[model samples]
Target: MSFDDVLQRGEDELLSTRPRHSLSWILASQFTASTVTAFSKLILTAFYNVELKGLNHLDNAFQYAKDNNRAILTIANHMSTCDDPMLFACLPWRYFFNYDDIRWGLAASNVCFTNKISSAFFSLGRILPCERFGRGPFQPSIDACIRLLSPDNSLNLQKFTLPPPILRNKPSWVHIFPEGFVCQLKSPHENSMRYFRWGTARLVLEPTIAPVVVPIFADGFEKIRPEEIDMKTDYLTPSNIGSTITVNIGKAIDDNVIKSFRDEWKNLCNKYPNKDNNDDLSDELKFGSEARDLRSRVCDYLREQVAQLRLQNGFKEEDPRFKDVNFWKRYTLSRGNSDPDIQFVGLNWAIKEYQRHVKLYNDKGEVIGEGKSERPSNL
Candidate 1:
């Protein structure tokens, strides 16, 4: 299938085709992720001390979660594949910080659902797989997430009181990595943060659950696990096991900002709103430029927050490449080892090797399939 076909297939099939949730699988995955996190922390402590810079921000977030103030969306930078599990590991384990029913996230389909095993593992880990770099909107996945995080279904309306009763809806939180893909740590562009994809902006602006976005900046995971990490060469490799990670959790983006973005988006849509639900994608393409302007209003704001957090944490600002027309092309050319020729020459080999090591590709180099195809479940 062509890349466009793959993207269409994801929009059509990903959420619907997911396997039915198994309670046993969910519990096992949680236990395993927790264990792996514990091991990672143990290994990391020997190298560098773990420091959290913005405790007050986190404390306030915890309060929001406890009180069920609003749906929480934690947006963080994607520096390493280990980031998800590491976030859980670094924070104190509390009932409010539960991952099973309370927290969920979107995972890259290619990376997380390479096979039935991986699919089940990530699915149980509360990750909903979506096309990562594919062209089309990951519609089903996005809609599903919006539904999962809808305030009405996920939170207990009751106010917090002494000896808080077991919450009914579980008060959920969904984590998002706006950068879309993991950028190389040593890339020249590493001085500044990468531009965020507009999908997240769409999610936040579309209303289902207007989440309070909490921005987090993390550094040093790239140091601990190299950017070109492979299961065989680096997963078990201990070269930089002791590297320390610094996480700065900034204050939640103002609710008024969300409202403003919503207003801007609604105004844009009003100009050429979809009259029929049949061609959502076509309608978007027909008015692509306008759609982008609408998306940018939210995407830029979120990225600016992340960029500010990075600067506050001592990282220098690099050029904002997103403003350039050739940014992606430049980013591709930048990927490689120190030697430009060798980096280009060995790029395919390196990618294939990494895929093989991670079981994303079989021994014969065939892509692994996510279980059987099906339609997304109804909300």
Candidate 2:
């Protein structure tokens, strides 16, 4: 298809026929959010060793768009409640939209009547909402989402689209955590991981507008506390123990790869029905396998594994990866490449696998407990 066709098709498949939440609503929400965000910004979000890596990928995305006049769409992991907010907060606000309009947009799941405060907070800036499945009338809601995302529709673009000078700016990025919410639960002993939705992947692939699908990895927002609500009070820093709360965004992922991964997942599920399929195969396994590259294979496997992880813990396999748990686990142990995908692969692997090892190595290499030799010959 032609370049414009990609955007057109994506819009046809994704946008709303008639927008919801009037233009007035969108503006008022932003107006209200500006005040709230202004206040929230003043409320310092304490930092505990947060590291940002692989931004070169996003930088490249911007540079590519500038050179080619194309756009980029990013799909990130929704492993923490703070995910969506952090993404907007972390981006170069002045580049994508008016710096003066950098406001926190809250889109609560139809909590308009029951949870007014949260609803307002999330539904603000260019606030777009995805239907809460089975909650109520959803077709209308889906249309609203599509309208905002449609290139022809200026409502979504007015806020998200950059100016000509801005277009030449960096890649226009708007983050969508397809998992929809955080991964961890309140209980300390529980080992369940939250599931991911394909909406993220679909947004990347079906849209001809953005050929690159960047994968963002979050290493630790799933910390378990004795009293979950008291996370602030019981905050045990990962870096203190040698692990850093890392946010690694991988290079733009090609659409073809997702096709193969999804195909493999579906094939495996159809072929082998009884196995415990959970994690998204690509992450749990590896990527580049189809490219005859082991590193890619390993990455694809790992992504798949993350899906199973969520599945095992009651969040049924949302992505197309629950068909082969072995492939996912094996990919985790497999040595990976230096590719940016490797970082996303490795980081998630650490979340499910290398956690204890991370705790042992700090700025200064201090072992958590001395070896048996240092134990003074017990008995």
Per-residue CA lDDT of model 1 for 78-184, tens digit only, reads: 77667777765667656223553345778777578778898877775667876542233435566555544454442222421222111224445778887766654
RMSD values for the candidates in order, in angstroms, are 9.1, 16.3
Candidate 2 C-alpha lDDT tens digits along 214-330: 566654444311113334543433222323355666666654675565555445434433334332123222222332233235344435534433343344334333233343344
TM-score of 1: 0.74
lDDT of model 1 at position 205: 68
Q: The CA-based lDDT of model 1 is what?
A: 0.59
The TM-scores, one per candidate, come to 0.74, 0.47
Q: Can you give the lDDT of residue 6 in candidate 1?
A: 22
**Clash-forming residue pairs, model 1:** 16-375, 16-376, 47-242, 48-242
